[model samples]
Each structure stands twice: as C-alpha cells, then as structure tokens.
Target: MTAPAPASSAPVPAAARHAAPPARAHAGAPRWARPGFWAVLALAAVLYTWALGSNGHANDYYAAAILSGTRSWKAFFFGALDAGSFITVDKPPLALWVMGLSARVFGFGTWSMLLPQAAAGVAAVAAVHSAVRRSLPGTAGHAAALVAALVMTLTPITVAINRDNNPDTVLVLLLVLAGWLCLEAVRDGRTRTLVASAVMVGLAFNTKMLQAYLVVPALALVYLAAAPGTVPRRFGRLLAAGAALVASSGWWMLVVDLWPAADRPYIGGSTDNSVWDLVVGYNGLGRIFGGSGRGGGGGGFGGESGAERLFNDVMAGQISWLLPFAVLALVCGLVLATGRARPVAAPPSAEAPVGAPPPAREDSGARRDLPGARAALLLWGGWLAVHYAVFSFSSGTFHPYYTTAMAPAVAALTGLGGVLMWRAHRRARAWAWALPAGIAVTGAWAFTVLRRTPEFVPWLAWAVAAASAAAAVGLVAARIGPRVRLRIAAAALATGLAAGLAGPAAYALTPLGSPVNGTNPTAGPAGSGGFGGMRGAGGTPDGTRGGLSGGTRPEPSEGTPGRPAQGTPGQAPQDAAGAGTRPEGMRGGPGGAMSEQLIAYLKANRGGAAWLLAVGGAQSASSVILSTGLPVIAMGGFTGSDPAMTVERLQGLVSAGELRYVMPGGGRGGPGGGSGGSEVDAWVQANCAAVDPAEYGGQDSAQDGAQDSARDGARSSLYRCG
Candidate 1:
C-alpha cells in the first residue's frame, strides 16, 4: 500500500522500548483471576484440614503446653509444661497464645488445637499470591501469582507442618506477611507501612526466636535499594522501622526477665533459669555452632552439614523436589529480566509544537516494570539463598520440618521464573530456552526424589520423566512452528506443570494416608522413619515416633525381653521398660494401658498436694498432665537436662507438702553431670518411700540394674513423700 518502511524506521513495539510493563490495576484484571485466586486458597484449606485428627495431639510436648495453657493463663502466657507452671517450654509462647485462644473458644480437643495451624497454612498461600500479583501486575502477574500459590499449596513440607502443631506453621505465615508488607512499602513509599512490616518480623521472632530473622536482610535491602525516596530518607525510615522491630520483639522477653524469678516459672533450656541464656546459648549461636541446646546436644539433627544436605535422604523427600527448579529460576530470572529503562515517549500535549518530539519521559509504562521485576527477583531470590545456606549447612538441630521456611521463596521464584521464561518464549528470544531447562531439571530432580521411596507410587517417577521430556520437546518445536505455536505452548505448560508438581503432590498426600510423626513431622510413607531415619523403622506402639531414639522397643532391663523387669516390691520400682499412661501419643510415655492405670492411681491419691506428681523431665510430665489436666512438675525440663529441679528444691517441695510423688526417668534421666545433675534423684531416693508397683496395677520391674535403667527408659514407678 504505502511505501515499504526501512529497517531503521520500523515502528517499535511498546514492550521493545521498556524493560517491563507497569502492573495493571487489580480491578482491571479478568474476573476469572479473582475466582482463581480464591480457588487456590480453598484447595489449600482442604489439603491442610483433611483427616487432621489422625495426628492425635500432634507433638504432645507442645500439645501438653496447649492443654496447660487452657487451664492456667499463667501457663498460657509462659508456655508452661504443666498447669502448675513449674517451668516453661523451651520456645516462646506466641504460637501457644494462638492455639490457646482457639482451644479456649472451641474447647481443647484435637480439632480445636490443630485448626489454627491449618488456617495459618491457607493464609500463607494467600499471602504469597498477593505478594506476587501486586508486584508483577497485568496478565503475566496473574499467571505468576496463581502459579506461586499453587506451588506453595502443594509443597510437601508445607502440607505436613500445617496439619501438625509445630510453631513453624505460624512463623511461616508471619514472615510471608512481613515480606508482602515490605513489598507494599516499596510500591507506596510509606514509612508507616515499612514499620508495620518490621512489626510482623518481630512477631515472627516471638514465634520461633532467632529463626524468624532469616528473611530480614532481603526485606530491608529491597526497600533500601528500590523504595521511592532518596538514599538518606530510606535509611532514616529503615532506622525507625528497626526501632519498631526491637520494641515489638523484646517487650515479652523484657517482661518475663523483669518478673521476679521466684514468682514465675523457671525458664526451660537455660543453664541458669534465665530466658536470655536460653536465647543466646541454646536457641541462638548454639544452634549454629553446635553443642549449645539442652544437654549440649545441638549437633544438628537430620543429616551431615554440607551444601548438598538438603538433598540428603532425611530432607530430600520433604523439600528437595522443587529446590533445583527454584534455583534455576532464580538464576535465569535475575539474568534475563534485568535491563536499563528506555526513555518512553509521552503523548503529544496541546502546548507542544507540531512535530516536536514528545518529551522523553523515563520510567513510564513498561519501563517501571524493570525495577519491580528485579526487586521481586532479589526479594524472593535472596530469601531462597539465605535459607538454603542456613538450613543446608548450619550445624544445629536441623529437622526436616524446618524446610517449611523455604517453601514460600521456592514457590515464588518458580512462578516468577516460569512466567518470565514463558514471556521470552512467546517472543522467540534467546532466553526462551529457560522454560525447557527448568522443566528438564525439575523433572529429573522429582524423579530422583521419588526413587528414594521407590515403593511409594513407583510409577510416578517414570510419568514425570516422560511428561518433562515431551514438554521440553514441544517447547523447542514451538520456536519454528508458527502456525501451531499456541497449541504447543499450552500443551507444554500442562505437561511441564504436571511433571514439576507430580512428585511433591504425591508426597503431600502421604500425610493423609497415615498419621505423621508428631515430634518430627515428615511427609512420606508410614515407616519413612522421619528425617534421616530418626524414628525407628516400624514406628512406635502408639504411632508417635521418638526423637534420636527412633521409637525402637526398649531392651529389657531385667527378667527377659518383652516382659516387665521384676524386683522386690518395696525397692525403688524399676521401669516396666515402656510402661506408663499413654496419656497422648507422645513418644517416651508409658504405654497407653500402663499410663491410664498410673494416671488413675495418681488422681485418686493426689489429696492436698500442690502437685499430683513430680517427674524427671517435661516428656513424662507432659504425658501425665495431658492425661489428667492436673499439676505434674517436670523436674528438669525438656530432656530432664535443664536443672530446673535440684535436691534442695525437691526437698522444699516435699517439706512443704506441695509435691507428693516422684518418678525419676520422666525423660531420659536427669543424671548427675557438670551440666545440671541428678542430685534430686539422690534426695528422692533418701526421703521418699517407693510405692509397691502392685498397689497401682503396675508390673514389678524393680529388678537388679533396674534403677540405672529406670533413669533412661520410658516408665518408672511412683514414690510417695510426705
């Protein structure tokens, strides 16, 4: 028609001139997008809440605390091991507060106790979706946001932890909220918004102490670099936000510290009954340096410390399925999505002379998207990097469940990277190879993870490999097949998504098939032992797996295997090996039959005593308290190792008639040592009368060598003290 245009004079598309397009307003997005977001959340809710009660009193250590909290506001505030408030749990009580409030309102039962975490999981998925959608607006943003939410919802560890009672569930939600708030501050340039973001992190700190700070560097750096303000103003606002962070995180710690030691419960996991010591020595540097937690046993749980630790047998099933793909996305997104903003032309105005070049307005329209895309890449990429570094190599107690903290970052980057690569593929750019590369790596990794549990859905690994290969090939074919590009792209996306998600989706569904281990929740087949085979191969009698001990049947202390140790009736009664009221399904408790008898005996005989029984550790005391809702003092705390009770303290309780019964091995015996010893054991042996095991329907295990074994075994006979 008109003269053909020269190569140099061809009209440039708006996208070619700008690094990224501005986000479209939420109201302008397709109506289907809103419904799709809610659908993702609904899916998460169903996944988290289904068959939750199968995990009865999940992590009864914390479950016991929740019950105690329901009975005593003091216990609720302090996260006490028993209603008597003798000692606090090792962790802070923010999570307890949420579960406690729910229990209080709904009545403390399995459903009420676990529902909060399930709700928190859905909220976390929602937070991730919102963060991604708002940061990357328009059609692409919607796709990325939905994909991110779906990935998070299907993450194996994310599903397992949310259904259980761990504090990590709430901690993950709070951290995500903080990330979103930080993003909002960057978009709006508001100091108040930034302060709110810091407050969220502080709350997360209270949830899990130092673990919550993992995302702080990313949150602060993103704002400092990309927020709409001068460098000094951003720094000043950050200072103010930092002050807010300190205030919110410290108020509870300060209150607990200032309260008179005699008036409040003893701080658990501390060498000297100080919360500060627990924070600094046990939960802090001790976790990273090793040998700082209770009994100096912080030598990192799960597996060996190295860059590949996340892929180890103990952890790979829980989190590694998507890890390689997330890493690839992070690298490709950072490299391909970054570019200088082009000077966009403004629409001609009335005052501008005819043919005058429109004033070159920089950072308009798509140009603004460059900083946002890069900022998002940095925020999520840094989150994944920092957590990966810490969890993979930190020489502390590294439970597989701890990987839930990485889920959001992994989900976000996968969505972000997939969407960015798809955009490149559509344009037939050099970076189009990213999509195929991501699919291939993710498929291979998923196959590898599935092979670890070969018996579990054995066909799934081959299916994933096939889908990934087909998808990668289709993506390559789309480059030259212009007439069929749309069909190929859609098929490739479906196959790639199926390949990427199949392994995690199968793992995520495993929790529903059986009750996951309460103490260390791992998402796999029933006998997967927990992270690194921490649980015994077959699991425990009550279905709760033991920590470090693996829930193996205890070797007989006397008589013969599988029989209670026999001894003189009046001698300090020996452990029946694994006997006790299985008050709940917590590992290291007396067998359910034995514990019922024991709880019944204590309830009947606990007249006028301030405490119904005093046991060696929180493990045993938690079992007893959960059974009766009565005060049972945990003598030494978590491992029977915190030195919460001494000979003098036990004597004072006996002399005051506040404590009447004593059992030594509540949890792995609080024996004599440089670290808080069993002087209380000696005191009780001297001043207390051993009740005959026959008196309470208990087997007589008090044979030769029984006393020594009693300190480490699950069940010990009752002793009566005036």
Candidate 2:
C-alpha cells in the first residue's frame, strides 16, 4: 500500500508536463519603463543628445550639404554627373535621402540633420533587444540587450558618427534589423521574415552601396547549417530574400545605368564608363579591389595589402573594443559545438536501479534553455568576420567608418558570451572574486590608455587582457559551481559595461577645442558662438569691409580720416579666402558692429547668382553665405588643395566677370599685390569707383574716427566691386 505502483510507461500529458513561458516576460520591458530602466534610458538619452549636439561639424558636412540641397537629389543617387564636380556620385543616396527628409521636416539645421541618426541609434538598441528575445531565452535576451546598449554607449566613434548626419548609423541599424530577421527566418522558416531580411539588405545597400551585402551570405550559410533540412524547404524563401534585395537596390542601379554618360562625374577616375560600369566596376569592384579604373580612390588598402588595411582601419579603428569578446565567444561556441565541454547533467534519481542510471538527455537542457543563442552567435560573429575578410582582402580603399555596421554583430556575440558565462557560473564566490580584480586591472589599463590617449593599439591590448582574465575566471568558477560563477560573471559584465561607458562619457564631457586656433580654418573653429562676428565687419581687427557676395569682393569704406587707404605702402592685404563664412545674413557694420552690410553686399553684388567664396579661418562666413540665396563655396583649405590657388582661380573668374566680388574680412587677411605701398588700396579704389558711396560712407566715417583716435593699429577694410 505504501509503495506506489510502478510509474506508468505512458508519457505525461503535454500540458501537465510542460507549460510555455508567458509571451510577455516581466523583464521584457526596459528598466526605463520600470523605474530603473527609465532612469537609465533617460540618462543615456540626455547624455547622447548633448554629445551629439555638442560635437563640432565633421568633414562630412560638405557631403551633408550636397545631400540636403533639393537640386542635388538626383546626383546624390546616380553616379553620372559633371566631370571634376565635388558633388559626384560616391556613396549611395539612401541615407542622404533620409537626412534630406529630416532636414526638410525640421529645416536645414544641425540638430535636424542629426536627429535621424540619433533616432536610428536609439532604434538600434531596441532592435538588439528584440533580436535577443527572438533568438535566446528571456534572461539571456535581457542580458544581451543590456550589453548591446552598453557597448554602443561606450564606443566613442559610434557616439560621434551617430551624432553626425552620416549614413553609417542608418546602415548599422538596418544591418542589425536584417540580422534579427535572418535569425528569425532560420528558426521559423517564415517567408515574411526572410523577405524582411532581404528588404533590410536592400536598404543597407542604399545606405552604403555594396558594403552591406557582406553579411547576407554569412547569415545564409549559418542558417543553412543550423537548419539543414529546412533550407531545401525554404529555398523559395531564400529566392524571395534575394528578390527583395534586388527590388530595393536594383531601381537605383537601373536609374543610374540609364543616366546619360555626359551627366556622370569621373568618380575615382572611372568616368566615361557606363552607369553599369560605374556601379559594378567603380562602386562595386573598386570598393574591394585595387583597380585604378574602378571607383577606388587610391586611398584604401586595396590589392594584396588589403588585409593589413582591413585590420588597421576597419577592425581596429571601428570595432577594436569588441575584438576580445568576439574571440572569446568564438572559442566558447566552437568548444561547445564539438562536445569538448559537454554540459553536465543532473544526477540520476534516488530510486534508480543500482546497475542502471537514467540516460542523459540528448538535447542538453542548456541548448533548450537558449534555443537560438548559439546559432545567433555563430551567424553574427561569422558575418562580421566574413564581411571584414571580404573587404580586408579586396583591393579597394576601406574607410574606418565602413566597419561600424559590424559593431552590432560583435556586441551581440559578446552579450551571448556573457550570458553563457553567467549561466555556467550562477553564484558570487565562484567568479565574483575575479570580477573586482578584472575590473581594477582593466580600469587601471583604461586610465593608462586614457592618459596616453592611444587611439587603437593601446586600447586593443587592454581589452585583450581584460577579456582573457575574465574568461579564465569564468571557466574556473563555472567548474566550481554554476551559481557562484554566474554571480561573478554578472559582476564582471557590469564592471565591463561601466568601464566601457566611462570613455565615451568623459569624451562627451570634454569641450571641442576651437576650430580657429590652428593655422588653418579647416582645422575647425575654437569658440562656440553664432557665426555673427565672422560675417560682420568687426570680424577682423583691420577695418577692411567684407560681405557675402557669392563671388564678389568686399566693398571698401569711402574714406577714414585717420585710417590709411587700402593700397597704402607696406600694408598690402594678404589673401584670406578659405575661412568658413559667417552665419547666413550676418554682416559687420561701422566700428566692427554686427552690420547688415555683409548681407546687403551679398544681395547687391550677387545680382541673382554668385558663388560665395568664404575665406579666413572662420566657418561662420560660409554659414552666412550659404544662408543667402547665392551658391557658396568654402575657400579655406578645407578641400586640401591650396587656398592661394583657389583664390587665384576665383580671381580669374572675377576678372572675367564670371565671379564679380570677393569679400575679404571675416578675420581673414585681405588681398595682396597693390602697387607701391598703397597698391592694394589704389587698385581697389580704382576698380570699385562704381560702388555706391552711400554704401561705404556710414562705416567709413566711424572707422575713420576710430582709426584717428587709435592712430597706429591697422583696422579691417571692407571693399565692394564697382
């Protein structure tokens, strides 16, 4: 009676034996929605927004400007354009189109331009969370999401790029979405999911051309391996995925192909080639191989040296911090897959016969616990590796930013590794001792690197040491007890996350030094103020007059009682053409007051069309000139070409009346080559005789009085063309 009848051989009811977890887990919501999650998200948002806004304008501003203009839209998409045009078709236009839309909605302001990128970054974090949830258990998913966000937050380059209006941020987000879709398609064999993957790949192409295709094959291969039988069944899904990619990317290709050859610019010297030639040869092949006829700009590590360049620029520059975690995850995955470290099973039940022990589970509970985790890890890691390998070994110039799309994959792999370590070591003592130790060491290393400010190499060394130490500690702790190891691993992860954030936080806090202090204005300006002074008369110490005439010269003040004439002997003005222009519409007035004079000059001299050539070490001038209706060109050495040569060329146009005026002030040196000591003044005086006296009279009298009082120091001169 006491002994229970032998257990029935019949299987337990499916419902009674196992109940699926709720679709919505308590932890599914971010800590921000919960008090903790909210606080974290809010703080991060604020920090990131401030950093994004505060960053100085990057070099890509030129590209952004070209993209933002309504007229440039077609050129933005197709490679066929005028020869020697800076606005040539280079990158795909999808990102620019998004940015252009944002600019349209919010107006062409910096904040508006960057808003899309910031939004993309935020969405990426959410995407990572969704991806993890779809691919792993609830706990691991949450961990992975947290890790992804932290990784992004901590990466300085990521923060800077996302803050700017660049295509990389959008590409990265699209890639992450595609990755998640690929994982879903593999696990569920859903056609829609596969199609989604294809669409994302297409968007990625639009964002950055062919670089986005790097991940597709890797994802497909991993999926094929993970679901061996499903591939044949889902062959149609694969084709659909391919179709989606083509649909999304093919339109641009076709449009570009049909574009007239005369309209296309010689990008990377592949001009005179057909649109298809430009797309595949220059954009496609030139991007990965060292071919002069292709779009390769002779800048990247193309040819046999590509591998080295890839490691240095793409990997080390972009994803250096994640390399350690990636390596560790790879090793762990390979070991687990090969059965080298078989998961330990629960001991046999107490009632088992003396000679018989219950059979070990075929699908280890570990695998069931994180059903798609291994597959996801393999897919993402392999994608990144293969993507880099393709580019690294190719003969095309690869920019550091190109690798940014791989960051999400690396972050996901690292997160998976962390989750696995935590699962294996569940308690504090087993791994926690090393947690503090690793943190302290890594933190010290970080401090050292910070002090040294080593860009890529030093950072890599410390990251490697930290990762190795953590892995050793984790493995040892896991062997002792799962609980102990988990606690330690969790602590270590928290420490690493915090450590990662420290660099970006500190960088964000630091002020961007002035762009003007350097010898060249292209170096960036020093002070942070509206571009008023640079556009106004007081922009320079000398009383020279300057204004935003697309290509007109500064109007001269009539006559200052004490101030010497423009062409006074030994006082020839130096050329100051490339300094950025002031904010749009601002002009310096009498006694260097903020005058509408510059704006008036722009209107008067531009006569409907003139290219504003902003010189000096000021960005404000360019900003001001652009704000005017006239097409503005930066004259400063921003183009890496000689500013003097540019000025000479502009002068030739001005002499030909193709360009009418030249505005000199804005803290830039005035034009040189006046006859005698007064050559400049005389030359300007003779040429500008037709300018309205009234225009110079107001500022001239005041500046004259000021000069009379000072009697020695040279004041800025503002001259207008006759």
Candidate 3:
C-alpha cells in the first residue's frame, strides 16, 4: 500500500498546539475568569451597597409590621398574614413571606427588612453576567456585563425597589433568572432546561401574580420560533410544568381561602375565580380594567388614558433609561439579520463542496461575532415590548414601580447596545470608557439631586432628552465606519447611563418625604395609594399620631374577654389588654421619663382603649407601638382624613376595646403646641381623653418625676387586667 504514503512526521508547532480556541467555542466561560468581569461585578456590589445604605426606609412600614412578631413557617413561606393586608390584592404573599422570614432571622430593623432585596439585586447582576457570557465572546461579554451592572445600579426604579422591602425586587430577580433559563434552553434544548424555565416562571408568578405568566408564553413562542422542533414532544410535559407552578404557588391560595370570610375582605370574589382568573383576571385583568372583581377596579386602560398612562407608568417606570438603547439595539439587530452576517462557523462537514466560499460570508462578518450581545438584545427587547404592550393596553391602575420585572431586561439590552457599538468600530474602543464615565456621572447626579434640592434637579429629564437625541444621531451614523460611529455611540451610551443613574440617585438622596405616603404629593387623588395601603389596616400619616379612638372606652370588663390590664409603666405589657394601656397623666409620675409622658396623658384622659392617641405622628409611630408587643391602632392623617382609611374606617376595630393610648408631639395634630389645634388634634381631644394639667410637666420640668407617676398608673392598668 505504498507504506501508507510514508506519512510525513513533522513535529507539531508549539504555537499552533497552544493556540486558544476560537471565541465562539470559549464564549461560555464564567465571568470570574476575566478581570474585567470581576471589576464590573465589584462595581455593582459597591454601587448597590451604597444604594442600600443611603436610600431612606422605602418599605419600613410593611417590613416593621411583618417582622414585629414570630410568624408561622406556614405564613412565612406560603401564607400572607400580618402586614399582608396592607398590600392586599396588588401582590402575592411571597415577598412578605421573605421579609417576615428575614425579620425573624435578622431582627426586624431597617437593614434587616431591606437585606433580602439588596441580596436579590446582587444575584441579578451575577445572573446577567452568566447569561451574557454564554453567547458573547470575552470582550463583548465583559462589556455587556459591565453595562448591565451599571444600569442595574444606576436606574432609579431599580434602586428604589431593590432597596425597598417590596416584592418587586424578588420578582425582578426571578424574571431575570427565567429569561436566562429560557435563553439557555434555546441553546441546549435539553429537557432539564425546559423544566427549569417552567420552575422559574412559577416562582415569578408567586412573587407578583400574573406578571410572570405574561412573559412565559412570549418566551416560549420566541424559543419555538428560534429553534425548530425543540418544544416538548408531548403537551404532558408542559402540563406537568404548569402543575408544578400551581403546586408551588397554590399553597398560599389554599391557606388564604381558609381565612374567615369576614377576615377575608380582600379575598372576596376569589372563590368563583379560576386560577387563570385569579392571575390574569383579578391580578392582571382587574388591575387594568378597574372593578370590584379584582382588587382595584379603576386600574385598567379604559378608566384612564391609555397611551399617556403607558408612557408615564410602564415605560417611564422601569425601562425609561433603556428606551433609546432598546430602539438602537432593535435597529442593529434588524440590520444584522438583513446583512446575513455569519459570526459562527458551521460545524465541520466531511463532504463539503470543494470551495463553498465560507458559507457566503457577509461584508460585515459572522453572526457569531456578537452572539451574546445579539441574544441579549433580542430577548430583552422582546420582553419589554410584550410586557409594556399588554399592561399598556389593559385597564388597570398602573404604578410605575410595577414594571420592575422589565428592569433586568432593559439593563441587558442596554449592555448589548454597548457591546455592539464597541464591536462595530475600532475607534469605538474608546467608547468602553463611556461605561465608567457614565457611572461616575450617575453617582455625581445622585449626590446632587438626592443630597441637595430634589425639586430643582432636572438632570434626569435633560439626560433623557440628550440620550434620545444621541440615539437618533447614532442610528443614522451607524452606516459610517465603525470607528467614527462607535465614538458617537459611546457618547450616546454615556449620556444615557448618566441620565438613568440621575433619577435613582436623586431619589436616594431626596428625603422621599414620608415612607407611608409615596413620593408623589398628588398620587392619592390619582388613586395611586399603592398596594401597601390596600393590604394594611390603612396608612398611618405619621407613626406618632395616635392609636384608634372613635368613642368612649369600654369598661375593663366591656373589652374583649380575658383581656389583660396594662403593665407597669416602664415595663411593656403583654397580650392585647396590657399592650393597650396608656400612660396615666400629662406630667411626671412613675414610669420611665418617656413612658410617664405617654402614660400621664392616658390616665388623665381615663377613656377606653380607643382613647390612646399620638398627636404628632404618622403610621411609623403606630408600627413602633405595635412592635412593643402591644395592640394599638394608628391613624395616618395627611390631609382631610386618614390616608390609611382601611384602618381609619374600620368601625369595628376602632369601636372594639382595642384603642388605649395617645401620644402627640411629632407634629401630626398641630404644630407642637401652637395657638390653635389642627383639625386632627381638635378631633382627638374632643373625642378622646385629654391630658390632666397636673400631669403636664412644665417645659423645663425634670423628666424623672413625670416618668415615675406615669409608670405607677400604667402598672396598675396591667394589674387590673390580671
């Protein structure tokens, strides 16, 4: 056989043997392998940590309520109880459950309540990096990850919800994970991938109800379109996935259903509803259309102006920062498709044509060149479009924050845009500088708007305008050489990033005024009280205002049976009765200085449990009172009446022997002892107990004297209960 053609034996070149694999083949490496990736990740951590520290108590009211007591594992995991009532109907119980559990573990302080959200935010950044790395080469992937981190850290809405004890953060994280899973499944087409996608979607549903479902079908459809014949062979697997979701989420529904009908006011109309109805109808349909069937009836598109509402709420709420980039990415994606670029080489074929001409390479290059970037843009862009379109067209009361699910997607797309620009031109290499520049600009913007006068800083608005202008210019200039176009693109991205960060930074530094009432002064009239108001007894204007008191207090025997008396003044009481006891006089007595001040006023009034009131306070005071292991009602009156009317209007709770104390010094009732009392103060004194003059310690009086007498009276109240 000619000695096997005497195979030549030339030593393999070390350089050839050691050469690294092609970018497409090694694209899926973990972010930790790259220094730039770690740098981006570290930046995200620092930025988010700063946000957590500086942001005011965004959801302290709910966190306080949920963390106040030892919650059942059942309630902590599946059932929504306690503070659940405040956000009723608007969101599911998962978020509260997380907060409750965290509080149980960490102690229900501001940091504790917010810890979970911050952690989730960090996890989201990591997930974004992982997802991007899967399809994009090293440099592009790192660039995209960096961009994503910046977007997540800088966006106002992202910072607001991630740092708040709201469910939005959890939902956002789940959605991002779900997106990653779905995209991964497309790449691998493995059964486990499908199951994972299903599981993620289910968890997402549990976090915020119908929102997860809305994106699921869209994702599935996209997958089917992108990869032919990859869907499950039988519908049974799909059903199984759906069933798993239901099982995971149904426990809460089942427990909630067990609640007494009278106690389940928010759960009304739920029995007749199907799971779809519960999700799509009540949570989804009802919110948009506004009706009693769902939680809030006046929420949908019909009741409000659709386009304007969408522009303000859905678009502006979550992804406004990425709007320009999204458009640019979309245009680029279309261009990429039309150009028929082949970034990835085809698998080796044994019988390939002698000269196939490299599969007709496009002028621009191969599609695989920006695989990760392309995938991110496609997935996130589609997600935003579908999510906004559905919510925008539906008839529901749209709060800008509800769109938090789209935040990760927006960030991903923005990141992709950055990568695409850099890849398009050698000159654009400088554009990568925009990523860090944008971050610095954003940080500065945050300090200015938040630390200084929030009202005066219009950086967010201006940034948006500038970004829009740049996007227009970049889109037209895209046809230019990659070098020149990339510079413009980098500038545009920097401008957008700076703008995006400005809003949240401003929000962080700004007082946000009061935690209970949202930032918007006019939100109340617009019916934008938020789910927090709906779930709780009602909103408390200021924590120090006062406990519930509509009528004269019942005799000790007249209150709930077996109710214990108030405890010793200095000692916090136990159970409902002792918890309800107020200080005895207006001056120094027996209890500790603070206790005496509170108790003296209560004893002098001698009103029933409902008599206790904090004159100058808001819902936070009520939360503090409740946290003392006491039962009390808080009245939050921002204006004409109590803003938290659910608790305010509950004639039964107010009339019942629940109310007991009154504290008035935090400016709720009237400007601390002004000439004339405000309407709230006038009502408190006329209907509830008045502090005795003897109890009133002079302005310069010693606090100890006032405290002892009050403590004695409070102790006696507790003894009376015993």
- Which candidate number has the best lDDT? 1
Per residue, candidate 1 scores C-alpha lDDT tens digits across 518-542 of: 6677776434535323222223333
lDDT score of residue 423 within candidate 3: 53
> Per-residue lDDT of 189-297 in model 2, one digit per residue for the tens?
5678778988998988877777788888877776566642344655756777788889987777676557664454323223443445446765688766645424444
User: Tens-digit lDDT track for model 3 on 1-722?
Assistant: 12225556997543222111223524564554567556756755654454242222333234334543333343243322232221132356677767667767754444455667778877887787677655456666666666676666555555545656667778878877888876765555455766777788777777778777767765666455443242454244456556766776666666665655344423312324233445665566666565542435435322254554534422342335455455565565435433444454555555655575443434443343444344445677788777777666666555556666666766776676656544554333433343333334333433333222222333544554455455445534544655576567567555655555555444332222222222211111111122221101111223111111211112123111112233221122334322222222110011122353444454454456533433222332333333343222233221112223232433344466544444433322323221012443444444555433344442224576545445323321111110
Compared with the true structure, the alpha-carbon lDDT of candidate 2 equals 0.47
Q: Roughly what TM-score does model 1 have, to 2 decimal places?
A: 0.86
Which candidate number would show the highest TM-score if scored against the true structure?
1
Whole-model lDDT for model 1 versus the true structure? 0.74
Q: Write the candidate numbers in order of decreasing TM-score.
A: 1, 2, 3
Instruction: Candidate 3: list runs displaced more than 4 Å.
Output: 1-36, 39-43, 51-57, 68-90, 228-239, 258-282, 292-294, 297-304, 310-318, 334-364, 368-376, 421-627, 631-722
Residue 201 in candidate 2, Cα distance off native in Å: 1.2
All-Cα superposition RMSD per candidate: 8.0, 12.3, 12.7
